[model samples]
Target: MSISFKKLIEPDSDLASVISQWENDPSIIPLTRPNQNQEELDHREEVTVEELMKRMEHHQIYLIYLDDQLVGEMNYMVDPSHLYKKETGTAWIGITIGEPVGRGKGVGYKAIQFLENEIKKQGLNRIELGVFEFNQTAHKLYSKMGYKEIGRIDQFTYWQGKMWTDIRMEKYFGSANNN
Candidate 1:
């Protein structure tokens, strides 16, 4: 399955649904929401969509669509720290496909493919992502896409009276000479 990249807009029903599903997903919530209230779901969703719109206006976010449907979303941003400011043009990415049928298929891979193309198009040399330790499914996908775990934070989140780690992965775009 091919994935299309688009900008997310406010008042988009599909984006709303995706946000709702993501809120309820155990894997995503553990990382995105640590000690948040249940009532904050709707508010968080609204704010996130709004922020995505603002970032899109700045060329920092990209929404993923599968066959014209809003199945997932991803984005890239410049590395904030000065450590990677020299050689590595780091950009972050996040994705969540609400469709069950879209999970096992090649949709996620296609999204990553589009992400790579989009990052390179924006003149970025590397794409980075932070995945929760328990999100093995996403880890597999990123590994298959040539992403390597460059670092990991231990006990990054203390939520629900439990601790979890976040794995940071990075993928270099294009060959050595190009970057």
Candidate 2:
């Protein structure tokens, strides 16, 4: 099936249901935030939905769908004060696919492709993201997407009764001819 990205502002009932599922899914705890509890999840969901609506105003976040079914979500954050390096700008990214069947089906790579295109359209030179050491799946996917490991924080995250490092990955986007 063809997978595409759609920027979601106010989610419909179907999309809201998918976001709610993602918010409460235990699997996301390790991949997303180490310390997010139920209450925190509720608060985050509200804030995320609101932020996404605002992002739709600026076309910064997108909802992924496969054959019209909600598969995942991605957001690109470009802050000149932080992620921008010289004229080569960069974006901080976040993504999650709540459905199990979506995981190993190449959705991650497709999502990254969509984000990279959008970032390039915005004239950004690079994109970056941080994944917890425990998120091996995402690490592999990011590596597959040509994101190089630039740095790492050893034993920085404490969660799930253990500690894990945070790996910072970057993908440089030069001009079309150079890329």
Candidate 3:
């Protein structure tokens, strides 16, 4: 099925409610949360819609649709590190297929393709994202899509009987590795 994107606004559209529900979802919590310290386990906490909007002021979220049905979401923001330095434009992206029916399909590939095209149109030459090391599935997906590892946050969490890290990956429009 073909996919499309629609701009997301909080506390207004019903589609926004889907995102609110995901904030505390057990499956989603593990995938999205990051523990910066071993002693502090952050479930990422649930936030009110207004709070979410405020916190995400610099970012934009788009509802992902498949045949007019909401399947997931796409989020992108100007890389904070690149805000003042404009030599090379960069954007960080996040994609989630919240609906179970959308998982194990090519939705992620399509979503990244669509998001990348949109980012390029906005004049960004670089795109980056972070994947938990334990989330090998997502890591492989990004790798398959041309995202190469730049570095990692290293050994912040222990999961599944092992210590895992946050892998930072990037895809640049021109000569990423050299850049």
Candidate 4:
């Protein structure tokens, strides 16, 4: 299936509802959730159209579509702390395949490829992301996509009745001359 990304501009009610539903989905939450606490889970407020619109002003959020169906969302931002101030060619990304049907397929891999191309157009040379140590599936997928594990934060999050580590991964896009 061909996957494409649509930049989320103005808020749409249907899109907002889908995001809200994904936030509350048990199957989907664990993959992206930072903690296992019920309070943290309940803290996600229903996404409102207005809120989404406001977020659009500050973030690059995109809806992932397979054919004509919405299946997931991804977003990225320039390093907020200016960690790569001298480099100025790095961005952090986050992705979620909210629909179960989209999992185990190549949807996320393709979507990320598309996002990387888009980021390159803006002169970015690298992309970075974090994945929980327990999310082996995502770790494998990212590795297949050429992301290299840069570091790990041991026992950074509490989930599944234990502490879990967060693994950091990064991919670099070499310029034509370097390649």
Task: List ranges where model 1 is wrong by over 4 Å.
Answer: 9-27, 31-45, 48-50, 57-59, 81-88, 158-161, 175-179
**Number of clashing residue pairs in every model?**
0, 0, 0, 0
Off by over 4 Å in 4: 36-38, 82-87, 175-179
What ranges in model 3 sit over 4 Å off? Answer: 9-13, 36-47, 81-88, 158-163, 175-179
Pairs of colliding residues, candidate 3: none
- For each candidate in turn, the TM-score is 0.73, 0.79, 0.82, 0.88
Report the alpha-carbon TM-score of model 2 versus the true structure.
0.79
- Superposed model 2: Cα runs more than 4 Å off: 12-14, 34-51, 54-59, 80-88, 175-179
Give the per-residue lDDT digits (tens) of candidate 2, residues 1-179.
88988876565655666676786676775577544344443344533455446556644768888878877888887754433232345678888887877778888889988888888898877787788888888898899888888777676656666667889878876646233
* Per-model CA lDDT versus the true structure: 0.66, 0.72, 0.74, 0.80
Tens digits of lDDT, candidate 1, 1-179 = 56677755453555655666766666456655444344432244443555545666644556666667766666556764522223467677766676665667788788778778877887878777778787788898899888888777777655455667878877786668332
The weakest ten consecutive residues by lDDT in model 1 span 34-43
- Full-model lDDT, candidate 3: 0.74
Error of 3 at 56 (Å): 4.9
Q: Best lDDT goes to which candidate?
A: 4
lDDT by residue for model 4 (52-148), tens = 8887775689999887789999987776452322246677888989997787789988888878888888888888788989899899999999888
lDDT of 4: 0.80
